[model samples]
Target: MPPPLTTTTTTFLLLITASLLLTITTSQDSDPDSDCTNKWIHIRQLPPQFNLDLLTNCSEYPLYDNFCPYTSNHGLGQKTHNNSHSWYRTDPFMLELIFHRRILEYPCLTSDPNLAKAIYLPYYSGIDSIKYLFGPEYNFSSQHGLDLFHYLSKTDTPSIWKRNFGHDHFLVMARPAWDFSQPISNDPPLFGTSFLELPQFFNVTALTLESRAYPWQEQAIPYPTSFHPPNLAYLESWINRVRRSRRNTLMLFVGGGGISANPNIRRSIRLECENSTSLSTHETGYGKLCEFVDCSNGICEHDPIKFMKPMLQASFCLQPPGDTPTRRSTFDGFLSGCIPVFFEEMSGKRQYNWHLPEAEYGEFSVFIPKEDVVFKGVRIVDVLMSIPRVEVRRMREKVLEMMPRVMYRKHGSSLGLRSKKDAFDIAIEETLQKIKSRVEEFAAQ
Candidate 1:
């Protein structure tokens, strides 16, 4: 070894080493492409009416009362005071805004459409259609629908369309697919516009909350829940809390009946809950059947804590099909780490293929057919009781693991814990892969 250096020389060498390390770390952090791979996406620069207009007219947005509070934190919604940790009550329909914002802020986003692997059309079709359809003026709905179709048809460049006939492009609708594909009959019911019916959208992939059963083009995504964590620490803490939290109730059915066209199924579920509560004194020790609120009266709790309380404290959360086959509550159940019991396939099985694990049926959730619950005289409580405690724990763990994938963290959030991929990240990856596969298939032909 060399002779020991003087104090001044040693200090200078140590400082030089530290400075070099800092420089390298700073360069990595400041690099725009550090987090992004080669998959670059191009977002169409559409008129402000498509995206920005929705936020600009937030107060006039349909269900403005519910949409306004959840607009902050990059559409992650407002924070709750009930919990010590960071939790939000983000609106499910605000996904359009979140997706648009995330794509614009994406590290892999390219201004040149020529270099993009996939094209994202940032249109607020869900809110736009809802505004016209929900209004008293029916003709406005029809005219608005016509105008949207015309706009898309006229504005699309020949070069873009010729590339793959819009196969590489995608649109994200925050509402169900049915909301945009209204029947165009002789006497069509004016429920929604026929945006999806337009020929220009035929080859395009649609990312919607609910997809049609016949067509495979529409990919089902998770409805935004109220638990957007800022970072991995918050996410892990919440998951740990859920894992350790006492589940006092055996099962919970927290929705109203009489709202749907066929309310018999919902009615049956409510009746079962009532019956189970009344018979809790018997030997089965079925525990308690908790019904948080009556959603039929349109008085359901919007508070995140109130909504999650019953789900968190319950072993199984009843997930009956809502107005659509899927309900936002399904995601809420996943967030609470409560095992969800489904009555239909579309409710969870067919939907959320991108986010959920490719596990066999009943591996992570319970699937009690509606007929079994209604016609065959099977009880929800009896089916749940049949499962072993060990199995229930396993299923809950799987659900807890899925919590991160379903969550949409704050846009431009630091990628702390590289393994923790959020909804936006997953969507972008999937979209790019899909476009690549489709392009390859076309080339092969």
Candidate 2:
């Protein structure tokens, strides 16, 4: 304070301050909650036959709906509104393609193979699973999968494949794990590519929608929901809206009317939904209205809003087991801040513990055993209304807190928002951790 500082000295001090500030800002932007791992991922852009070529013939893929429409816009489905940047008709089963698009802009992605902790194979195993079932490749063996396997086994391939003998490699499949697994005990041959069953692929970790059967190698990732927020601001605003939403519906059920193969369970649900709609004010106290979408004719009305709006107004959503024990509606309900009412343990936390490990599922979900609903004839409306109001508020708040991690960021775009980790970040972070552990456990000889 006694003497004025020289220009050179002042400039040097200023430079140091600026550098410190920049470092802080970068750290804040890169990792808001320290969920990002120090390791990087190298994405393998496989040949067209492995991914894009199969996508081109989307019709050959299996689904109840027309597959081509769902594959549009990098698996974001068709646009919903004029704002192409924010809105999309995102399909639940198109998770692999959405993850593929996200990896292109992953923050920790590295070009140098040595810098990566794990190698991502953007293989469209979902489409490939049913490709031979429909296309000219029908009756032929699953040669494409074998081709990918051979490509990885090649000596000229990246050293990442050779380092741990494919232990560090991972795949993100949109379908359930059983779709790629082989049938045992001389059972009727399951229509599969036998990809996960390959002895060479045993170490290759796969993140899938349903991992209940093969919990060791296959981890369950959240299903793709309709919403894909780019950053924290947009996501928070949506959460605020959900929080302030005057939920007028008591319960909501959106699925096929009664055409499910296991019709007895769904048939009972349909009857209850119909009965709930007719409940008198005395019978159903608060949040009296119950709504359901009879999607037997056309699932989800082919409109995201048609499905999302009901969830927004609902305090609880019915999540019965579909063809599989789990359904995308569970994620959709949570994302919309609607507490899910699950019928089976497998459909709830047992299968998707990775999605929200810290979540005490009972705090955020209502569990009514399948036997209670299907056999004992429990009333969904009465059970939902019986929960204390304070408890309902607590559950919805917990859901809002857990909501951000359930979404996949829109690729090649920026929203300039602030928030915790998203689905892509968590998936890659946990994946890299797994790969790092595997590499250390089985060091190369």
Weakest 10 consecutive residues of candidate 1 by summed lDDT? 7-16
TM-score of each: 0.84, 0.84
Candidate 2 per-residue lDDT over residues 1-445, each given as its tens digit: 2234334324423543454344334544564234445566666657656765555555534443456676666677777877755567877667877877666555555555565678889787877766644445444433536778777778336556776788888998888876667533224344555566667787899999887554667888888877776666677678888899878888888887455456366777777777765667664554656787766655574466777788888899888887788877788888788999888888867877766774688888899887887778777777888898899999999998888777776764454642367788788778888878888887843
In terms of lDDT, model 2 sits at 0.71
Q: In candidate 1, which residue pairs clash?
A: 88-226
Residue 222 error for model 1, in Å?
Answer: 0.3
**What is the TM-score of candidate 1?**
0.84
lDDT (CA) per prediction: 0.70, 0.71
Per-residue lDDT value at 233 in model 2? 66
Cα-based RMSD of candidate 1: 11.6
